[model samples]
Target: MSDKTSEAKVHFRSNAKVHEVDLRIREANVRLCQLCLWRNRKGIGFHIAPSSSSLPVICMVESNSPASAGGLKICDAILAVNNKNISEANYQQATTIIKTALNTKGRVDLLVVEQKFYKELKKNDISMISSSAKILVTPHSMPADFFNFPKHQPRTCDIHVNQDNKTFGFEVVSGDDNIGIYIQEVAPDSAASNAGLRKSDRIIEINGTYIEQDSNMNYQHYLWIAQASVYVDIGDDKSKLEATKLFEFVLYENPLHDNARLNLAILHFNPSHVHALETCAIVGLQMNHPTEAFIDLNQVLHFQPSSAPLLANRSVIQQFLDDNRNQSC
Candidate 1:
């Protein structure tokens, strides 16, 4: 049967020259480019910046390629772009400028103070993209009189809330490009989850206190101290010192504090507390109970139920279990 199947198979070869084959491939590639040209045309934009450090009112408009037809001259000192205060503009504020221009169709009006020529103009119309293209242009024309752009508003309620120490929880963590806390996970059957802590949350503050990066002190050390002192009525400075001493003098402490243990539970409950969880889980696993690591992942899934990462974490626990079985062999 195998011999008959092999005999039935057929193969063919083309004897075309390299140049002829190359031309055919090039033709195929051009078809793909033609199909995607419409998508490319739809994506067009530009940015603006403050003209000088000395002049608070000075501004500058930069033209981006293919979308440059909006009639904005290079070095045009803009007083305002899309009705925003130009003096407040900074590096992060540039994103606001691009978003505003793109959202309002291709129309961008600049309130400019032309520095060299010394002229101020309001409603200086500039089309954000090339006018020569035959593509359909959508007019911005917002509501009769809308207020300023909505996306610029400051965010509130990013921290997940909960009830109490055992049943309620929250966490603060390091963020990218900004000083803030991000909620990575919340546990079900826990206070944080019940209080509405969800996944993908970037917490700006906790208990009205901003989460600033303390350059003078290590955040992980702070976390251990805080967790250790949760239940103790002792002085803040004394409790914090004891917590640090407990971990630092690991061998000498002999027995850890009950307050520290409770704090560890709370930190475990809030998965957004990354540094503390990593510390405890590593110690627990090294001490021969991999289940501690599994519990941390469970807290992660409480907030992000659909996460593939949490699913893979379950597989890791199973591997550890398998290792234990093999060891007994």
Candidate 2:
């Protein structure tokens, strides 16, 4: 068995050769490519970045891994998975398709083209990928890396529980990034801070137990369904946090989903569908996480620039941050 707790990503990449890809085209200019990977419960060892308008492109492949053995290369634009055309799929959609196939089938067949070739086709306004090709070009909703990753990379913090304190001095919380739970509010001079657990740093595991990607979506979706999209008890802060994890997982499975985005935010128990950033700016502010509040407000403002209430809320969060900075100084 592989040395992995789950197939969920938080991992490695490497370099090999182009021999892993089965070339469908004869010319170097030919963009069509293919890769059939044998996957374990863990995952095919590779990372894909959204490129060329939301198309999943092979960005990293680990050495001695299924993807590397299968001949997947960086910049290979994924066209379809398991023979389904995803020429127009966003990063979330593509990931969902891939995850669904991997979970049910235990193997994945990918149809891809080199990034340069896809760009060439786009440059010339070629939608039809040759009459023989299986995938037809679709319009792009993802213009680029809409998922702006934080400046920091994932790091391991070796915080030993103090014998006296017996606490790591941090709280775990789920946020918009569907990756993992983050370390919230590290106490200075405590085990977590001494080990470098900064605010917003994702906690990948605890005591050697890896947190898998597959989490129950019941709190947000099932409850919403049971009530016919109405009347979910937002019981308490802990309950809301649990629902937040559900929202993250649901969003992970389908980024374009309105329910995961909107319902959780506007859960005044109303029936009408909603969608505006993650849960709410007020929720983040109430939790005393100004950065998150700002992000939520910023996301809403991007779509509803004239929303006065949202703008006012953003101003409040901004002022709070400024005051905090001055205090620290």
Best by TM-score: 2
Worst 10 residues of 2 by lDDT: 13-22
Off by over 4 Å in 2: 1-24, 28-41, 50-52, 122-329
Q: TM-score of the candidate numbered 1?
A: 0.22
Clash count in backbone of candidate 1: 2
Per residue, candidate 1 scores C-alpha lDDT tens digits across 35-146 of 0111223443333433334222322221122222332333334444455545345545654664566566544444433334323222222221111112322223322212
lDDT tens readout by residue for model 2, 1-329: 35473332333221111221213232323333333344221456567775446677665554334554454555567766766777678888898888887677655767666666665444321233433344322112211222232344656677664224444577543433343454435677887778866554555554444553413332233323322221234345555555566665666766756555654655443222224353566656555668877987787777778988878878888998999999999
lDDT scores for all predictions? Answer: 0.41, 0.53
Which pairs of residues clash in candidate 2, taking residues 3 or more apart in a chain or in different chains? 7-42, 14-61, 20-71, 262-274
